[model samples]
Target: MTDESPAFPPPPPPMGAPAAPPAATPALPWYRRRWWKFPAWAWLTAAVVLIAAGAAGGAKKDEDNASADTTVESVADAATTDAPPTATDAPTTEAATTTTVAPTTTRATTTTRATTTTTTSPPTTAAPQPIVFSGRGDDVVNLPDTDLMVATISHSGRSNFVIWALGFDLQETDLLVNVIGGYSGRVPVNMNADTMSLQVEADGDWTI
Candidate 1:
């Protein structure tokens, strides 16, 4: 009279003891299964290294450019502020001049007579003419190669000379002509041809 419960497959192994279902295959993660995570870490490290190197290179380049700019600015300032004009900076041109002076000679005759003498020389140099160029140097030009002289002079006391010849001198020899470029001794230069006379002005040594 049975009505007894069916076996029901041994009650499904007691609801939790079914041998753990083969351990679920351990669920190998995306990184462990495909080995792609190793490459990804490598790529990330390489990217970081490249970024650091690029930054360092850029910094070095910027430093170099800054140094060069500073050098150029300093040079320009020195040239503008420190350097003054000198004689060797310009070309010399020939100027025409004439002079007549009367001198008194005393002889034993108890009477003095005034003797007049006429002299001619090149006109004294006037103030240095301003010439502009891009850079600093010495330049020469002319047909007879007179001089492209630049000089600086210094004088303390005043003298009673009429024409103070202050400039460089051109000394000629027998065989070859020597160029002595410097300040000359101050000498007197007078004129009687015309009323107005020309003279060279300098602040350095006056050459003969």
Candidate 2:
């Protein structure tokens, strides 16, 4: 009784002995377990956001380039339609020319002639000689030296056939002249007379 002293306390561990280990904590979920896991996830999320934004920006830039090309093509077409035409596109024409010439002429001429005149004269004639007459009776008369004679006689008688005779003596020959009683006209004779004489007779009274 008295000896049952209070349960004695356990004795102290000896020197150089290992201490007892602490009790282990319970295992958490995979997300909560590592301290660096949260920062790695945040970095991955930032990388994904950057890639999506870059793709969207690339698509928008391509759309803007297509619109610019279309606008340039429309401007070029309008400029071509408004320009003026060149010299080769216009029409061509030709002109005509003419020349004229005059003609020459010649004329003919004529010649003239002159007129002439003539004059004439008359012929010359010899003069005549006078004659001597004898009465009706027988008579003898001397004559001049001449070669030609003209004589006339007249008688008063009723007989139609009475003869009258006369004779002349030349130098070498004798010529006899005869007349009828009724003769009254003149007679002409030609003879050669060196010397000349005349004799007259009639049957009746005669005049010469």
Candidate 3:
């Protein structure tokens, strides 16, 4: 064996100086790379869900506002269109007043009538007079005659004088005497000297 190993010739220097290589191999086509694609599907689904939730919230707020507006409108209409009271439906104070007035008037009229009735009156009576006889001194002055006579006269000269009574044989009797030319009948005397005088005077007929 040769005592010293023969030195191998130095390795030949690397070809061209050591160079930076390309970054990576070419990616697979879209249809063929399957392992990491599930993450991409998950991101797309999350985005779609977020959009649907926002739309639903907006629709719910609009419905609530519309309902509140409808309630307010109904209240306003009720306030403006109420009905008024009618004549028959109101209280009856006037009827009471009318009834009271009628009764008062009737009472007053009745009182007046009663007062008038309380104030009236009545009548009276008369008297009586005495019977008498009268005559004038005239033509037939008789003496002891069987006939006895009595007379009456009217002062007004409107009617004839008449003898109202007579006596015969001293028994009194009624007799009629008729005379003319403003002369009453006669004056008489008896044998016993019972002389009688007669005359006519004014203020109605009287005996003396």
What lDDT tens digits, residue by residue, belong to model 2 across residues 1-208?
Answer: 1222234644566789876564344455555545465577877988999999999999999999999999999999999998887758557566677777767666677777766666666776766657666455566556665776766656664343222222253332334445555666665534443436656555566655
Runs with alpha carbons beyond 4 Å of true place in candidate 1 = 1-38, 86-208
Write candidate 3's Cα lDDT for 1-208 as tens digits. 2223224533555789765554455565555556456577867887899999999999999999999999999888886677565557666575544444444444444434444556555654553232354434322222233333333333333345433222344332333344433433333323233323332333234232
TM-score of 2: 0.33
Model 2, position 157, has a per-residue lDDT of 49
Q: Which candidate leads in TM-score? A: 2
Which of candidates 2 and 3 is the stronger one according to lDDT? Answer: 2
Clashes of 1: 21
Candidates 1 and 2: which is better by TM-score?
2
For each candidate, C-alpha RMSD in Å?
51.1, 38.6, 32.3
For model 2 the local lDDT of residue 152 reads 69
Which regions in candidate 3 have their CA more than 4 angstroms from the true location?
1-38, 83-208
Residues 29-63, model 1: lDDT tens digits: 44444445456787788899999999999999999
Off by over 4 Å in 2: 1-115, 126-129, 157-176, 203-205
TM-score of candidate 3 versus the correct structure, residues matched by position: 0.22
In order, candidate lDDTs are: 0.42, 0.59, 0.46
